[model samples]
Target: MQAEGRAPGVREVAAAAGVSRQTVSRVLNDHASIRPETRARVLAAMEELDFRPNRAARMLTTARSRTIGVLASSASSLFGPASSIDAVEDAAREVGYAVTVAHAASLEPFDLGAALDHLRAQAVEGVVVIAPQQRVQDAMAHLALTVPSVTLHGAGDAADEGVFVDQLRGARLATRHLLERGHRRIAHLAGPGDWSEARARREGFLAEMEAAGADAVVSREGDWTAASGAEIGAELVADASITAVFASNDQLALGVLHAARLAGRDVPGDLAVVGFDDIPEAAFFAPPLTTVRQEFAELGRRCVARLVALIEGGDLAFEEPVAPVLVVRESS
Candidate 1:
């Protein structure tokens, strides 16, 4: 037993388990070479003694913090960013690494640099950047990062440096659904121009429209909010010639639905609408939304796998961008 009023250390646990100090350390670090039975024995010893390994002391000796840093923007309120953060945490834990997150104050280069600096000071072995905007990735490209990094939602601008859902393809799928429904004069409610996903979806909408030889009218950029969608949707429906609308996101699509109802236009009968990001509340929308779904959980797993590969100097195999699914509902 440990001395009165004192906790047992690694040395005591090693003695109790009849293993060397190095073996106990291996079990604590989850080293792959440790035998299953040996690992169990060490764990039992730890539980019996109530011994806790000090992470800082381990880092000092092993130089492995087993931490992955996340640089996030708009994570608190935004669904996509928030989901990505959660998925990343789950995946990292499965691989015996913890996550440290630093939110950027803004997309400015200085702010992003400061966030990265904060992560660096934490001794994170690698970083995953949830960059939804083109400028965020662009800004990070210029910054000097000693550790390996991966970006999300960067639209594949940096070769194999990021993991992302195929926004362009998903947008094309949404636009094509409208075209297939015989909507000739189609309108698009675009997200903000600065966002990479918005730009890709807008381009995809225009491209698909041109390919179908249909007349396409794109509204002024929106702020990815239902209010913005409602305002732009009101204008698009006013044209009377436009019979369908493709919104950049579910929130915007909800606004479009609101505008259509106020304008006395029945959805799919007067105006067919499609949206991206099949958020949880989408199916419960007034008419049930037909939208594109991005598998954020899969994207998160791939991001962690890719980043861990880079951090551990493993094979740098290229990962294909995750595909989005087109879900058809009453809205379209």
Candidate 2:
């Protein structure tokens, strides 16, 4: 039994398990040659004693930090980026790696470089860049990285490290949903121009409209805020010919809903709306929003897995771009 108010250690665990210190070490490291019964005994003893191997000691001996660095933008509070960070942390925990985050104040090259310097000081084994803006990507392209890295947003090129969602495909799915419902004249409330996601979504909407030979009204651009959406929505509702609207994100859709109500327009009857991101608040809106759902959980898992592969010098398996799904609701 452990002494009162004292934490248990490996020596006590080995003694309780009737094994040598070397055997306990082998068990902790998951040595393939250890007998199953011996491993089970060591684990049982560890559980009984509440013993945890010292991560710092392990790093010192193995010369591996077992940590991942997340380089994020100041917009980490936003739903998409916040969820991505959470998912990355969960996936890394599952793989026995800790995560350290560094937030850049802006997309400026100096800010990004400072953030990278912070992560480097932590001795992170790999990096996951979570900023979705094009300028950030361009800045990172020029920076020299000493460790392997993966990005959550990009064109999924070889340089992107095979970690991305198909934003264009998701946008097409949202646009097609409105089109199939007989909305010929549609408008798009796009996000900020600097965001790669916004550009892809706008392009997808255009492509889908052209393919269907429908009127594609490229409406005003918004800042991915409900206020911008509402401002754009007021103008959009002015044109009664525009029967449906596809927004770059759910927040914009919410703004549109608000504007439609103020204008006495009936959703689905006078106007249909589709959104992207499928944020949590999207479902509880006055009329539940019909939106495209980005598979953020899968994206995080893939990012960590790809980073791990790069760090370990393993085969880089080419994965297909993460697909998005259309969620139907009363709003559309």
The number of the candidate with the highest lDDT is: 2
Reference-based lDDT, residue 203, model 1: 93
255-292 per-residue lDDT for model 2 (tens digits): 99999999999997899999999998889988999999
Pairs of residues at least 3 apart in sequence or in different chains that clash in candidate 1: none
Sliding window of 10 residues with minimal summed lDDT for model 2:
155-164
Which residue segments of model 1 deviate by more than 4 Å?
Answer: 2-21, 31-33, 44-53, 74-76
User: Please, what is the TM-score per model?
Assistant: 0.91, 0.96
Which ranges of candidate 2 are over 4 A from the true structure? Answer: 1-4
- Using TM-score as the measure, the top candidate is 2
Model 1: residue 170 alpha-carbon error in angstroms: 0.3
